[model samples]
Target: MGVIIVLIGMLLSVNLSIALDELPCHFLDSINITDGNRLANDDSIEFNGLVYSRKQYAEINYVLLRDGTDQITVDPYIRGCICNIKPCVRLCCPLGTLNTDDTDITVCQDHDKGNKFEAEVIHKNNETKVIPLERFFAYIEGIPCNFVYFDDDYQITHKGEISRGNLSTKLTHQNSCLHAGLNAETNEVDLRLLTCIELEGDDYDLNQYHVIRHQIINFCMLISVVFIVATLLAYIFIPKLRNLQTNCLICYLICLAISYSLVIFVTSFGYPSFACIPFGYFLAFSFFSAFFWLNVFNFDFWVDFQSKHRFKQMSERKKFYLYLVYGFGGPCLLILFIYILDNTVQLPPNMRPGIRDGACFISNILWYFYTPIGITLTINYVFFLLITLKIRKIQQDIAAERSQEDGSLMQKALNEKKETCILYLRLILVMGLIWIMEIVSYLMDNFSPLFLITDILNSLSGLFIFILFIVNRRVLRLIKERWQNLRGKATTNDNDTSNLISRSAAFMQMNPILTIK
Candidate 1:
């Protein structure tokens, strides 16, 4: 039931997005539309008044102009009206009141070829709208205007004159004819039909960013895959070469190697282009990492175990068993437990590969929530405690044996003890450090806000393995030794002539008169 609900929700959301995207480019039939038939501009239309003997009239037209181009012909569908409000008052002709309306009528009037006239919205539907004209103009400047107007004057001689100027200044300024009557009892002006003219600017398309981001994400996935494969092969094919194969360190490499490969494969190659990387890899590798460390932990156990000490150096089977129990067992349990939780409860967003972009690592759930952490800590603590007791007993036994040994043997035993303890401590420290990183990684994956920082730090897990295994002191020493050996061989070859000369001289001395064939 729950699965069905989730599926339904996902389908609905995706479908809605697709549906909205599929709509025609010209969605709104505004008075004025921009290029691509998108936004409405205010300058697309102009309304002008028709004058007569003491009376005037109005009409309007819709004009289709290419975005950013010159004005075109007027449309006949839209209409405008012009009327005189109060009787002709003061000779100064303070302001002309044109009817402000809901219908498409944009009025622009210059009372004098000299008197600067302005239009302002006063009484709309016979009620006072508190917003002032200047305030409204400032507010509307940001928003796309659907209507535009020009001053069209019809002469008494049946001739019309078109004065070209910004309709906004006429409508917004105080003294313009488009302004309402300030006198409250007089002043009337002529209003023409509102015009619709198409205008144009920026907001044309918005899909470019989405496309670029998608491609970038896919590119990252591809690169990550390549690196994963290369690093994994490097480990698998390259022999220990030195201290590279020493402890649970290989586990770290294996975890990262496998994790990234899975991430790339899941993200780059699947149905719908990507699939949620199955948590199985995380479960497997994380556990493997833990298990490997556990093996490092168990080395002390195997070395101190009665009769097992001799087998440790020679028996591969015993080593394998120790590794399996310590490194593999705990992580297996932990991963399975996490898997169970994932199945039973909704995992955190990070844990679940975005149904959109398929990849997953230690998500916020494991990092922030202490459930998995507390469990891991408890297990490690118990193992440490057990190992500590074992180590103490081993020390005690060595001490007892030391007292009975002769002076020379005692010294040898003491030296070996010191070396073992040093190696043991080093192993413990390295392993502990790796574990600490694991915990830190989990915490960071959960709580860290900076994505780039988290990503860089996440690489630390893999990087530590690469450096430790690929460039350990033991490995470097082996390389150096091999280089020196090769150099020595080359030197001997270079001395071949000297050896031959000595041999020839010796032969001549022995045979008094030596003749060459």
Candidate 2:
């Protein structure tokens, strides 16, 4: 009898262990949705919870299971069984097909048709002494089967639409999923999931395009730095290049170089949050300074073409000092005004100057940056047109006087007008094209192509100016002449050293007898 009792106790122990193992054990809170989406697609998760169905969708019987930490929708394949007494009346049926009018109590089944199930609960009870369903068997912690038939309000979450166990919507400035898989060894998707659903196809292509765009911009900036520095040095050292027009060009190059340098610096080494305001300030100032100097040069060109004697009366230094106020001081005043407005006025969040979309750029273009730039560009364009007509009229006058004057004099006159026209064309190509592309890019809804064009043109402006104005035949000639002069001076110094050495040898020879004595 003792042996039989021990055998019965062991049997009961084994049965209890099996029952405990089959009980709902996994907590919904511990599982990450992104990880669960990848690894637990076919895996069954069991949790203890109450099924809360939407009141309007009573026929479909789709329900949400809320664990203490998180919530997930259960599959519609779940079946309901009623248990009232020792022997429960088990009616196994699909979610929509369940006729619960005759039965008030039901235990959630693990499978649709099989008898393997757990978690007994009361369903649709209105009595005061009713017991709520405490245990729930969630087949999957994600969207229910046939989710497309559900209404829009059903899947909305704080982050975005909860679709197929993934947050398919995007938040403001969100880039990638926080819970995306990092380990390759795990059974998970390796690609970084986007924060938003890809409504338009070719998301990978778009990402690649942005990467290429930045690469091109960096390359152009590097080229601009090298050429602009060379141009500035040439203007400073070479006397022939130091006219009023070239001085203005020097200022423009300086501003362009600073702007490009700041862009590269911010891109390579990201600034802190506090640096955004200063960064925006300097960046806008430099850009505006560049445009202002370009306008100054345009006006100077028009002045030279329209009234040569009057332009010559204004000394290069005087012109530079006068234009400096407009070129540099104008941006300073604008920056000061913006700072005051930012401090005194309460602007919208979008209008404030701070880091947005991962870069320190002016967020409000219409008021702060673009408007001024647009006005300056319009003025420059008007000057450009007037200068073109002036050049044409000069050419016509020179042609008429060609029969009266010497051939050489007429040739020289024609050459001067030609040079003026070339200069104006170069200026337009460098400044006008870039700003036009910028304006078009700003106006367009889809700016992929326009942004590419704008970046390329704007970044290469310094290069264009250097090539057209600074690296020309005249500048090259000056550099060559200076190099030749330096070489001649070095040869003369070598000859002088040789003569001094011979003189010392002769003196030693004369004093040889005296030294011997």
* TM-score winner: 2
TM-score of 1: 0.37
Error of 2 at 288 (Å): 0.8
Q: Write the per-residue lDDT of candidate 1 for residues 60-179, one digit (tens) a residue.
A: 233334222334545323221111221111111223323222121223233333133323223425332333223222110011134344334311000111122443322211111232
Worst 10 residues of 1 by lDDT: 154-163
Q: After superposition, how far is residue 227 of candidate 2 from its true place, in Å?
A: 1.3
Clashing pairs in 2: none
Write model 2 residue lDDT over 56-133, tens digit each, in one string: 011111233421224454432322211100111111232222212211112222323232222222233511221211
- Root-mean-square deviation (CA) per prediction: 25.4, 20.4
Query: lDDT scores for all predictions?
Result: 0.39, 0.54
- On lDDT, the candidate that comes out on top is 2
lDDT of 1 at 368: 26
